[model samples]
Target: MSSENLDVSSELKSDSSFADRTKSVSIAEKTSVIAVEATSTGVEGRSHAAETSTDPLAQPNDELNKCVVVVNKESGTVCDLWDDHFEAELLERLKANGWEPGLKLVKGEEIEETVVAAKSRKIGGLIAGGGDGTTNSIARLMLGSDIPMGILPFGTLNLAARDLGSPLEPLDAVASLYPGRTREIDALELGDRLCLCMAILGVYPELLNKSEEFHGRNWWRKFTKLGSDFFKAFLSSPKMELSLGMDGTKAERVKSRMLIVVPGHFQDDFGIIPKRESLEGGKCTLLVSKHSSAWSLFRMIGNFLLGRSAQDPDLEVKSAATLSINALRRKKVLLAIDGELAKFKVPLKLDLKKRALLVLDPKASEE
Candidate 1:
């Protein structure tokens, strides 16, 4: 589902769809786990002769044998919720499915090392267990490779995992990883940067900046500081004169406070939360907000929250295979790439890599 509003204020918020469930998942003991040996194809666990009727009905075949699960320890779900007991239970389920788990907690340098190691061992499928940023990092490495990837949905929204039809439950998501059909989806690329979800420009990144500070401060301090930052940003919001050029289309110029570009797969019915029905298409949706007034922002958000169309009369929506965004009246502008704030050079170009990444879809092979 799409967010309640396009307010940059909620930019840093992760997916909160399943946040309220407090019951803990009961992890099975290690005695219930099986072990696997690393091989060129994947980790081989258990033997055909030992195959028992008690095993789960959908088990990975030999060609699909080794599945590596790489968890970003710094991710919200892994850091806050995962523990020794959870890890043990997850391993047991992976072993039962004839897959090996390559669990890690590192981000930048160490993540690269892990990908190299997995490739050397010829892993069949790779499962990324973390938030959107972590998922993008791992998926970037798997692009254009034959190795299919899975999503564990440990992030706040788990948007990518949900779009792939993965189960939110850790064990269930893992089991659905293997013995599943692979779906190739588009990944947005801006030179060396890869965007798995959506990209935003203008006030959204400023909101994310304030959000990053809310992590370590007290409630009062954070609230006051955030409030101050919000007013300052709102009062000083820039009306960017942007010229957007799409392939085979004329460049269009508009003055707006923000621009959101997402793959067409993320498009949904009006008033409904935006979700991708299929990842096969090689197109994207561009949303341009024409008004920067407070009332307009509130109205846009209120519409979305009420399950009504949030289309701003001044807003513009277009379908394109490639987009060229240029700040016609200004220089450099603030950009948010998958929620991470940064300064993007003027005249930025975004292209769609259709079917460039192979992902494991839980419902692909379902009856």
Candidate 2:
């Protein structure tokens, strides 16, 4: 199985494919309800024969026995959903799995300092629980390290965890952490900055800013607010003029209002948030909107939602091994690297490197 999208409904018991894997999984207590449940059917599932990555699974290592779990107390899932005994339950599960687990539950302010300190201890693997920003921090810190990352779905979107097919529930995530095989995954690099998932350029982040009002405190992944966000962003988004192309080539450049760079590209279908079938291949697709006019933007999004052809006149689809993006006359551009916003130097080269980071996949072992 590929890892994440598992059904929690009563019908899951009737799913023949999951029979074997589910037998080994010990469901946790219901009293400890998580803010974020697992992904719905068709996302990804904990298939022992993992299907998303092109690479074969690495040998199971005993070194995973020593791990340090870094939890963010400020994340909506942890703060709003988890109970007081959550830490005890997590540690107990790790211990039950034969790991010498050390726990560090810290507030958002101490994440950076705490992660550095934890890495110095030379633990075999680092497990992190928090939002997308927290996931990005650990990815940047431990990018090339030998130790792998195990994710807990405390983020609103939990995109990384969803991709890894790890359990989204708090204890279920910890339960699967040490049991899975470690896999080397791909990531997008920009100068010294690296993004584990996708990156955005232009006014798209404004839509997400308004989305939080609709999201409120219910942190699980949902798209009911996309309509509201689209409406709000349309009214206030500033115009943008950009030039996109590959480096050392002046001929390939094209004008654009926005850019959505994804590793392995999004699924053709939309309405649900876009997902990639695989993130391992050294490939990326640039989804660009040529004009910033309200009508053009509407058509661009309309084509995407309807799952229309990628070769639409208003939207330019460019698949490349590398991408260079810059504003018309600006020296800097606002970039959202996995939901964290920052001003990045223009003429940014978006490069894809395969197996850039090691992560634990919720792979089932033969019983």
Candidate that would win on lDDT? 1
RMSD of 2: 13.4
What are the clash counts of all predictions, listed in order? 8, 7
Per-residue lDDT of 1-367 in model 1, one digit per residue for the tens? 1121122332234433222321352211212223222222221233431343222112434455666667655454554456455665776677776665545444434666666566555556878877766688788898888888888767655567766777877678887765446778898886566777778887767676656532211235544665566555754787778899998578888887778888764433553334566576898878787766668766666654453433556567788888888888655666677655556556777888899999887886464
- Angstrom error at residue 86, model 1: 1.2
Q: Write down the TM-score of every candidate.
A: 0.74, 0.73
Model 2 lDDT per residue over 1-367, tens place: 1111111221100101212322333322221212211122322331221233211112223454667677765553555555434555676787787666655666566667766765665456788888777787788788877778888777666677766766767688778866446888888877666777788876666455434432112543345556556655654665566766763466355555467888776656664445565778777878776655667766766777776637468777777767777677877666767766655666677778778888876654222
| Poorly placed runs, candidate 2 (over 4 Å) | 1-63, 209-226, 235-239, 269-271, 291-313, 364-367
List pairs with backbone clashes in candidate 2: 1-47, 1-48, 1-49, 3-45, 3-165, 4-165, 5-44
